[model samples]
Target: MTAAFAATPAFAKDVIVQMKNQGAASAMVFEPSFVQAMPGDTVKFVPTDKSHSAQTIPSMLPAGVAPVIGKMNQEMSIKVDKPGLYGVACKPHTSMGMVALIQVGKGPSANLATARAVKLPPLAAKRMNPMLAKAR
Candidate 1:
């Protein structure tokens, strides 16, 4: 006699990123600004303070992925299905260097260079440079 067992499917995880008024490194920042996630994982942007929103940088998106913009003080979740780097910014505070990086899957992607080449405001660039360097 043969016995049969039910198979359980793997579940996707939700990664939480907090938008804070003050972080350990700076003010008006995304705490844990750099995240590494697998494809299919969901990133939840939680606004811990008022006037903070999470929006995607167009030049940093993977091919076929649409840009996302969250309303200020609202919680937004994004499912990362593509394998590449994604750059996020706080619309109200981007000029103050409020930015983040999310690298999905392994290895560098084709658009990494393109993302790097996109010009950003001086302060935003300063904050993003280190996060970009950590990708891959």
Candidate 2:
């Protein structure tokens, strides 16, 4: 009987994504590289600092495309209706490791872990090194 009830999506994973500011000059990404959500599953992005946002976009999105940036609301939730790889990033600090790869459903339509290894633009690289050095 318990097993029958468990078949519902009530047990689907709920993730809390956090954005934290470490200092006046630096911030950090506390999001996971891979998150799995079923169709109807929800994910929350919480801002732990004054100026941070979690935005979702298509995988391999072009540079100028606008992302779905989450605001500093009291609470926020995102429902997954499609099975695909979603790219997440912080608007102002994405190059500083403020990026996440969300996999909806049982598998990712595209793998973004390797994309993380792609070389950053020269400016993005310059902005990221200082924060990374501090983290180390």
Candidate 3:
């Protein structure tokens, strides 16, 4: 883990959402369901492939919020001082179950809402799939 990962505040720890060579579909869903963070937490989405990206959209987020695009492995930071669920996903693989759930607080239920899971366009898999495998 890098200093940034460890330096994550007690309330929030740096979480890594890693993409796999299995293809864009694999990158879509994080093996672990819930990524925990605090008020000022930073999460890094390390795309195995350069084409992959982690983006947030208002439609995807809770009400009264706008989506922010965080480039893969770009070291984006998030502050959830208030209480709510944040939704995230991969643009290329949204069609193929590539969704992430971020819980920003410690309490009863995170109550994070689910985002639309999309299936990887067959061609998208063909284009981005091998790029990741070669990286490994």
Candidate 4:
């Protein structure tokens, strides 16, 4: 008698994004604002500064994905199992342009346009524009 076995799946990894009060080019920012991740990878938002937190931009979440909100001074990790672009912001610093863009999987994202169209405060928009451009 013989038996057959299934191969194990690839392991998911974690991507660390730091929330800082001061970054190389700006104040109140997420280091490496643009991230490329694989499905099932975890995006961990580490608050290097206690004043910062990470949360999802409602209009920028992929279909079937729930919003992620973190408490100030705490860290948050979001497991991205779907393929698309995810927009994250710091509730208190969003207006000051503290945001991050996580692109999961390869190829184009179906929600790119929708994510770009979401209205943001002037500073947030200014900071996100470049990140969004690279998402395509």
Candidate 5:
């Protein structure tokens, strides 16, 4: 079974999303890209000594919520305010297929259909398959 935030009372919890490279190819990626969160949860995107900026995809954000963008390792903390799926990408490394998915709220799911229908680039499409499959 997947993790559910409903069982826990709403509170401020922080989840760190690391922007780094892995293996020989030095494939840039968002460590633990697929994350489960609740409203009021804070997702922080952290980069190494290098550069990386986090931003929400317009089409992938929930309805009525404004998209968020964070500067490099200098400043990055997204406070979720609604229950839905959020798509995050590294503005500089998106072409390298760097992407992340965040689910906010209880179990079952919310705004997933809309989130899945979003169109992504080739590399992103490939890396996102497994992440999306596990969302619930």
Candidate 6:
């Protein structure tokens, strides 16, 4: 193992998901709503505006995994340790569809059905369906 032939992905990744808010709260969104990473990667949720926080949809997480919930305007980071589809949403603006998805590795998701069955706001549903499709 020489420096010239190093395996870059062997290292952990730190990614940022920005919560963007337009003039009004109803226009809030997550910039770059879809993210992909490998195990050990950490996704950082940053509030780019006001009144927004990142939290995982429990049913969307892999078995034995816990959900992540962040405070408004405060950043949150979650280490990726499994292969599955993870959903994130801004609780306050859920109706505006402030949602995102994280795809970890290339394995088939183990909780897609439960994730889909989880209750979602109308706008969140509109925003998350396509993302769930591509993730699976």
| Most accurate candidate by lDDT | 4
Q: Could you tell me how far off, in angstroms, the CA of residue 64 lies in candidate 4 after the best superposition? A: 1.0
> Which residues of candidate 4, in runs, are more than 4 Å off?
1-9
Any residue pairs clashing in model 2, and if so which?
none
Which residue ranges in model 2 land beyond 4 Å of their true spot?
1-10, 22-27, 59-67, 72-76, 108-136
Error of 3 at 64 (Å): 4.6
Candidate 6 structure quality by residue, lDDT tens digits, 13-86 = 89988888863334677867878888779999888788899999887888888999999889988888887878
- Runs in model 3 deviating more than 4 A are 1-12, 23-27, 31-33, 62-65, 72-77, 107-136
Poorest lDDT segment (10 consecutive residues) of candidate 1: 1-10
Please give the ranking of all candidate structures by lDDT, highest first, separated by commas: 4, 1, 6, 5, 2, 3
User: For every model shown, what is its TM-score relative to the native structure?
Assistant: 0.91, 0.59, 0.57, 0.92, 0.83, 0.85
lDDT of each: 0.88, 0.56, 0.52, 0.91, 0.80, 0.83
Candidate 3 per-residue C-alpha lDDT over 1-136 given as tens digits, one digit per residue, 9 for 90 to 100: 6887766665545677765435433444543434666567776666654555677534434455556787754534445444445556567666665555565556332333223332335644443343222221
> Residue by residue across 17-113, what tens digits does model 4's lDDT show?
9999999998999998999998889999998887999999989978989999999999999999889999999999999999999999895898999
Error of 4 at 68 (Å): 0.7
| Candidate 1 off by > 4 Å | 1-11
For candidate 6, the C-alpha RMSD (Å) to the true structure equals 3.9
Local lDDT at 31 for model 6: 68
Model 5 off-target regions past 4 Å? 1-10, 23-26
lDDT of 3: 0.52
The candidate that wins on TM-score is: 4
Candidate achieving higher TM-score, 1 or 3: 1
> Where in model 6 is the C-alpha error above 4 Å?
1-9, 23-26
What's the true lDDT of residue 132 in model 6?
A: 80
Residue 38, candidate 1: alpha-carbon lDDT: 82
